[model samples]
Target: MTVETIDTVVVGGGQAGIAMSEHLTSHAIPHIVLERHRIAERWRSERWDSLVANGPAWHDRFPGLKFDDLDPDAFAPKERVADYFVQYAEKIGAPVRTGVEVNSVTRLDGRPGFRVETSRGVIEARNIVAATGPFQKPVIPQIVPEDADIFQIHSNRYRNPEQLPEGAVLVVGAGASGAQIGAELMRTGRRVYLAAGPHDRPPRSYRGRDFCWWLGVLGKWDLAAPAPGTEHVSIAVSGANGGETVDFRALAREGLTLVGRAERYANGILYFGAGLVQSIRHGDANYLSVLDEADAYIARNGLDLPEEPEARDFGSEPECLTAPIRALDLADAGITSIIWATGYALDYSWLDVDAFDEMGRPAHQRGKSTEPGVYFLGLPWQSRRGSSFIWGVWHDARHVADSIATQRSYLEYHAQAEARSA
Candidate 1:
């Protein structure tokens, strides 16, 4: 096997990897990005066809590139977002080797670096940056029975409503993806049932500007403090047209049957908990808490902002607030498709290093791994709440690159001293 050595090796060629490569190049660091598939493979293959970015285009810009020509306020589609990454790689001439799958990453016994085994060849590097973003693999619950007659698919594989069988659809997990997909399926004149969970649903727009703009002004996106017991809730706001809010209350009013958390699948039946109304109420309370914090911040800073809009009373929809049914037979309800939007799981099995925590996740502090010369990027809450977003990875990437440079300088100094002594 051929062996090549470099200063650094970056795994995964997504936004995080590309951003880190740009910073590493600016620092004159010799590195290459290894991708198992094409650049932005997840965005291209995993997302739905009609999906657009959850946030505005303005907030999704990378470090050196801006969406100058595109409307900053409009949400860019999935294809456009994927193309942006492709264009970025070309613009910066990033040293990305596509289709190169990493087989293993192991530390050198006596050396001061690591050996990365790949499908193409083996690379020895002083530093290794795992830039694989948070959504590593699709998570399908084991509770789903294998012998079921109905067709099932994860949100990653779902394209559009037409892709599924002609019948009612049950979308499990009412996060951004689940809510959006359920709403879209409803528009197709299909009956949709959403297995709701405790997920915060912020208004799409507030006053005369987007809610994201408010978050930016309030410094909410840059917050790094650990929020206890709120890890699974997605911060992504829904992207429904007509400036309409897309929360549980809104979806309920739009003819979506809201169920409780899914328990398990029995003999042709799916069981649910009885906390549907409680979950929705709790999620709304969480949303209100965020707005209250923003309001307090504005008041304390004495900043002149737009007048708060009059609140809409969602209490009129009392039917959605009722107790959920404990179980529903799939055949009786005429439901033929099940879409699991229960989020994703991280896989670092190829990494032959002991840098993971009890959850099998990489153990890193602000992108710096516990193991020397190893780093991680694109992890949710890695440095701040925005660490996993396209616009946020650059901040962590810059820090990791600087840390690598400092370590490289020290190694060189030590080598020179040893040569002089010899």
Candidate 2:
């Protein structure tokens, strides 16, 4: 079979792939970036129409690039963020080939490289960087049967509330996506119910600064990720309405029905646990933890930062928590649609390398996988808490590029030495 050969192949064309290409080019490494779709396709297609980045514009961006005349603290609209990646890729002359889908990656037979099989053709590379990212396949638990009466869609497929069928909406999973979508649906004069789960709630801003700034300054962003296959709690925060915190109490007052994590859907009814208050408290504790850390930092450093009184006030408990229901009859509530904001599952089945743990999570230190010449980028907690984020992913791409370059040089040196002896 005829096969194209390159020094390196980077899978994906999102922020991570493009960033990897930039670093590879800087290292004078010849490579090709294969993108299944257009650059930042997920941002353009997968996300909801009203979605805004959780991070502020300045903090979410790559190094030496601005989000086009926007203020530092302003949360960039989704389209603008996609445009920024495209613009950055073009500026850096990234070798991105769009619409080229990679089917599998396997080691070359008795060779020191990998064979990447794609829809276009086969390409052999000395090294491969799996930058497909954390959000791949949408995860939908089988709590509800396939023949359920209510229409269901994952957050990945949701565009806007208008697309959903008429009736009350039950949004399962109260992560950033679910909470924002649930709130948006409520604003459209539709009855919305949110299924609270284990998630951290961070304030949009603390002490006259965006939470992004505080995370960076306080070294929270430098926090390490848990071991591979370990589940991490979602951070439920939003950039909606310029920047707003999700106060369950406020959402409750605004007519949002808060329930515990969805247990099951049976007999035309949805069942929930009695952990509604505990779920809210989980978020409250996270919210308070960050505030306490920031406060201590200011006090220890003798920095004069004004304390916001309203933020610390966790008012009286809402009725939903005081009296949590165990079940919701779908027909009685007039619920016609269910949006599962249950997040995405990582899919590395196409990777024919022994670079993953038993749970199929990438088994690696930082971005380097266990298998030589096989690396992973943009994984959640791949190295740090910020590893999956745009900026953090970019930084990780640089590190991966350095590793590839160093390994390539070592291999070439050994090959030359063997040739001289021969």
Candidate 3:
């Protein structure tokens, strides 16, 4: 295959890739962004029909543009979000080639660049940024056998409740997606059972300010990743219902049976972990801790923010936590569907570089890999807690662009030195 040469090759067209492209353009770098689908395709296709942006419009966007038509506190619908990125790319003239899929990234042996193999063609780039974003592959736990009679779909493909079979649903994994979906199904008169798991609950709003604002002002956004395993764990906050706090205890009161984590399937029966109460308590603690931190910040700064009573009240743990369900028979409960919102699995199988950890995660320092001219973007906790969020991606992208520019200058300097020696 003929190789198309470029200075940089960005591997995604989503928020991360586009953001990286914008920075590279500003640096006067010659690069191309290859996307498997359209820009911000996940927001348009992978998400559920009712999904909205995680943060309010004013806060979660690039510096060049404000979501002009949207209110400061309002969360933009997913369609608008996709449109916003598309507009941003156009405004900055991002060179994004849609429908181009990158198959692998390997070094240009005995050289200082990379050979990116893609579906459309080959691209030999001096530098590469793997801006593939966090949600690469759906992670469906093997709790249920493939032959199980119940219908199953990952949250990536779930559009709405009406798409499922005419029966109750068992939603597995209670993160943002699962909680929002479970609540939606329950509202539509469908009997729902949610398999609760360890998730952080950040209030939708605290003292008249969005949770993101609190995180930013308190420097939580700048903080590094937490525990190793919890780095990828999603927060249980939803933009639906005009920004709602995902409280499992409240959902239980609304008739949704909250169960523990789905463990394994044996003898045609599903077993659950016995830490239902602990999981709920963990979310409650996180919720309270956030409120407490916000209150502390207000007091320290002497801000006039009023106390939010409801934000602090997460409700009492439901009985399911105390008397956890040991087993579940899908047929007995009339449940014919299972939605797996169990987060994503990191898939960098196409990376032909020694720049990953034992956990299969990219081993990079602030987006720069140990392997020269190779970088990773849109990763969880890449630089800060907000690294993966849309509002924060541009910061990481800028850093990656700076790294690329610096390396390019170094290479240019070395080439000049070699020419002088000759």
Candidate 4:
């Protein structure tokens, strides 16, 4: 087999890969990006037509470019974002080899650093950037009963609610994806049931003022600070900081029956925590009192300045309490479909790196992995609010690229001296 050598080989060509490629090219670094398919194929193939970004356009912009001629608050359609990425690749002249499937990477003991096994050929590079995104694989919860006759699908596979069954639909997670799908189904007049999970629910605005504005004013998105202790404070949860809250909650108020965490589904019956439905109602009630206290805190101390972090927004809370039941009970309520809004998992089995922790994530400091030259970008909670975000990947990418460049230059200088002595 012929062995080709390069300074670096970047794996995966999604948003993170593109950003890394751009930085490498700008520095005139020798690197090639390997993609499994045509660029942005996931975005083009997976997203729905009416889907807009849960976050605003400003938060979605990639490195060194802004999304102009678009509303900042509006979530750009998937197609638009995909087009932007395409244009970005073209503009930067990112060296991308599409339709190449990388099989594995093996560390070379001497000379050519590492060898990448791919369908096309073997590539030898001193460094490798695994830009494969975190959400490459879909996660279907184990709690989903195998014996259940009802159709079950992961959120990644879900394009729209058209494929759902006729009767009422039950959605399992309440994260951004879960909430969005739940709200959409409800809007289509389907009887939607959402299984609320441990998640933050932020609102579109705070007291009529856009929350995005506050995020900017607070300089929360700035990349200057190396590390902030309270970075994951209340802002960690979507609505815990007293934002407008999610569209899912609004849907719940509309008519969607919010359900408890599903323990399991078997024999067409969905089992949940005993009295969980009532417990949730009780929590909602207490949350209402908490909300009142929060509102009082906010009112006492204007939005401009508060003595301490604000309380969670619950409006006034629900007055009613109810008991949780099994999925078989759904038959009585006429619920039919099930949307597993459960979140995704990170899959790195394809990569031959030994730097991963028990959770399958790379052992890294900021962006530097335990492996000397290997680095990670676009990981969730990589740095701060910007870590896993599409726009935020650049901060980590830039830092990693700089570190690599410095190390590469040092290696080059030492090699030159050895050559002269020889």
Each prediction's TM-score versus the true structure: 0.95, 0.97, 0.96, 0.83
In model 1, where do residues sit more than 4 Å from their true spots? Answer: 242-244, 297-308
Please give the ranking of all candidate structures by lDDT, highest first, separated by commas.
2, 3, 1, 4
Greater-TM-score candidate between 3 and 4 = 3
- The stretch of ten residues in a row with the least summed lDDT in candidate 4 is 232-241
Residues 103-199 of candidate 1: C-alpha lDDT, one tens digit per residue: 9999999878899999998899988999999898899898777668988899999999889999999999888889889989998899999998777
Off by over 4 Å in 4: 207-209, 219-244, 247-249, 274-330
Residue 203 error for model 3, in Å?
1.1
- Clash tally, candidates in order: 0, 0, 0, 8
- lDDT (tens digit, per residue) of candidate 4 on 1-422: 57888998888888888899988887788999999897867778765555665466766687567778677666677777777888889989999998998998877886546788988999988888888876777777787565565677777677887877788888877666676777778878888887764443333554444455445544555644434442321121232112235643445678777766788766556766554344444434533443444456467667654343333444433321233344446567677667776666677676787678877678988778887677787777776666676877876788778878998889989999999999
**Candidate 1 steric clashes:** 0
lDDT tens per residue, model 2, 172-249: 988899999999999999999999878889888888878888889888899895535326677789999999988887
> What is the lDDT of every predicted structure here?
0.84, 0.90, 0.88, 0.69
Better of 1 and 2 by TM-score: 2
- Clash pairs (backbone) in predicted model 4: 168-336, 201-239, 202-238, 202-239, 202-245, 203-244, 203-245, 270-327
On TM-score, the stronger of 2 and 4 is: 2
How well does candidate 1 score on lDDT at residue 225?
59
